[model samples]
Target: MTATALPRLCVVIPCFNEAANVAPMVARLDATLAGIAWEAIFVDDDSPDGTSVAVRAIAVQDSRIRCLKRIGRRGLASACIEGMLATSAPYLAVIDGDLQHDETLLPRMLEALEGGLAEIVIGSRNIEGGDKQGGLTAARQMISDTGAALANAALPMRVSDPMSGFFALPRDLLEEIAPRLTGTGFKILLDILLSAKRPLRSLEIPYSFRARVAGESKLDAAVLLEFAGLLADKALGGVVPLRFLSFAAVGAIGLLVHLAVLGLLHGLGGVGFNAAQWSATLIAMTVNFLLNNRITYRDRRLRGPALLRGLVLFYLVCGLGAAANIGIANLLLRDGVLAWGLAGAAGAALTVVWNYAVSATLVWRAK
Candidate 1:
């Protein structure tokens, strides 16, 4: 296609470990979008299975197909943003690289954009003709249903399926709302809709969700946690980043762990109070680091040597935080602004805030 001959549709397929499905996905799109000019962008997260390598090989043969290999960062929403920004196509859309969504609906979805019938056309699996039984396992269907409920609760206009990984809309509108999008997790469709300046004129076309032909389904308990973080982000008007919220939530869990460990050691094990407190804090800090690394800094998760380095650094950070907590509490008490209990509470909150801020910037610094 010439520079002026940009395709009418740019399909962004955010993927991870989708090496086997890349070529088949393109062939399906080629058949589905027969008369329409379109391009498929496979945004890969540098999967260990060489997903980008497979996409790159195909891209060289077909100009309409392209690949964006992201390094370091690994969120689906961020990958979608990268793919959308790289293309010049007027009508932008997204689909799972796995053969789950009905690619045939893509034509009608674009039709809505071409005819100005709607600002967005989602390939929905919850409409009249569509249902979860088509391909979903009972557990997956339950997860999808629960996710939809959580997503619709925060959406400006209710949608039959807000957790859908497949959808399409205008590039201009996407660009307009891109900056406001958290771009953190698997719910890019929901993010785009929720971030819109005005309620979008949207329509959903019924389509049967298909079973995955290749690769593993990316959904899990972690995804639901991330979805909850997105809801919290929107509920707070984006005042706090989703990862920070995740960090804080994990910290709360750590607090409970600390108390439990302290109780077990001091009461049952007959350990000295100071010794039990120190041991409990250390264990809690380790738990906090692991949870934060897994959920809060998932895209920046460390491995092997990096993991070892991170753990050591985390210990130092928490140690400094503990010292700061004690110092601040003593200062608050001496200043006579707060009683011992109130001062300690403020200091503990300070420690949590300091650890969270420092951990993200220092322990798991993302580029």
Candidate 2:
């Protein structure tokens, strides 16, 4: 390819802490995509291990290599979206930076798209020629299988591996559905398929899911929760924002905490009702703030001093929320309008709107 020639394909590798795999991934791409004009964009979420530096080192030597280092924000789906949008390449492929995904499938995926055989091509592990056992642990495999099953149930068309992260699609198709994408989790492929206005013409290619040669696997229990949030976000057709759904889910858990604490303090410890309620409210608010930081606003998660500051702000914000909660519950208790438990639940419910609205704007506002 000449220096002035435009790439026909752009491979977007969303990564963090995968510096060791950088050179090898580029070498693999160079070997496999011999006749193709392609570029590799490594979207690093400001990896502490200097993954961006590694990419830039190679990029200085090779024009086709590029680095997009994101600061103070992170998520695979969002990284891939940003990388894909950074290129003018006609076709876009998303492969992992950990080298678990087969880079060899890029050409095949591109062919399927260019030949009009598919609108989106997925490198599937569940297919006959593919293998997931090669890469995933037993627990991870089970999680993948269960998630695939659940995703397929909700998908417009049944997919053998809706959980597969390795996939490719036309840049135009991506642009078409980009506006609808939640860009919140690991399953960008699922987000793409679900967000499409019309059922996309799809093809699945078989590829062995390779074991990682460098960096730790980013998959965790939290990722599953994010996946669930993604499903909920799409299922509602984006009526309720994704972050709000996560906030509400955390709020539900907080309610459980509040009730448990209330029971322990008031029922078991013989504390006064008002005192127990206040104690439970404060404890629940703390739990909710921590969980919200870890999950709901994960991309904008605060750390160190910021986390401390955010916690203080959260307490102040929810303190007002708690006031409304206690006031309503006390009024109901005094008037005999409802049982204690029901009154408490109603008060908590009313405060969710207030806390979520205020906290989102004040505490977790993007930095």
- Candidate 2 local lDDT, 92-189, one digit each (tens): 99999888898888888999899999999999999899998999899898889989998888888878888888999999989989998988889999
Estimate candidate 1's alpha-carbon lDDT, on a 0 to 1 scale.
0.88
Candidate 2 regions with alpha-carbon error over 4 angstroms: 1-3, 326-350
Q: Mind sharing the TM-score for model 1?
A: 0.95
| TM-score per candidate | 0.95, 0.92
Off by over 4 Å in 1: 1-4
- Write candidate 1's Cα lDDT for 1-367 as tens digits: 5455779999999889989988898889999999988998899888998999999998999989898887877888889888998898999989988888888899889988889999988888898998668778888788889988877777778789888878888999888899999888888888888889577888998889887778897676788888888888888999977777788899899999999999999999999999999999899988988888888888788889999899999999989998999999999999999999999999989998898889888999977
Tell me the whole-model lDDT of each prediction, alpha carbons only.
0.88, 0.91
Shift in Å, residue 305, candidate 1: 3.1
Q: Output the lDDT of residue 54, model 1.
A: 91
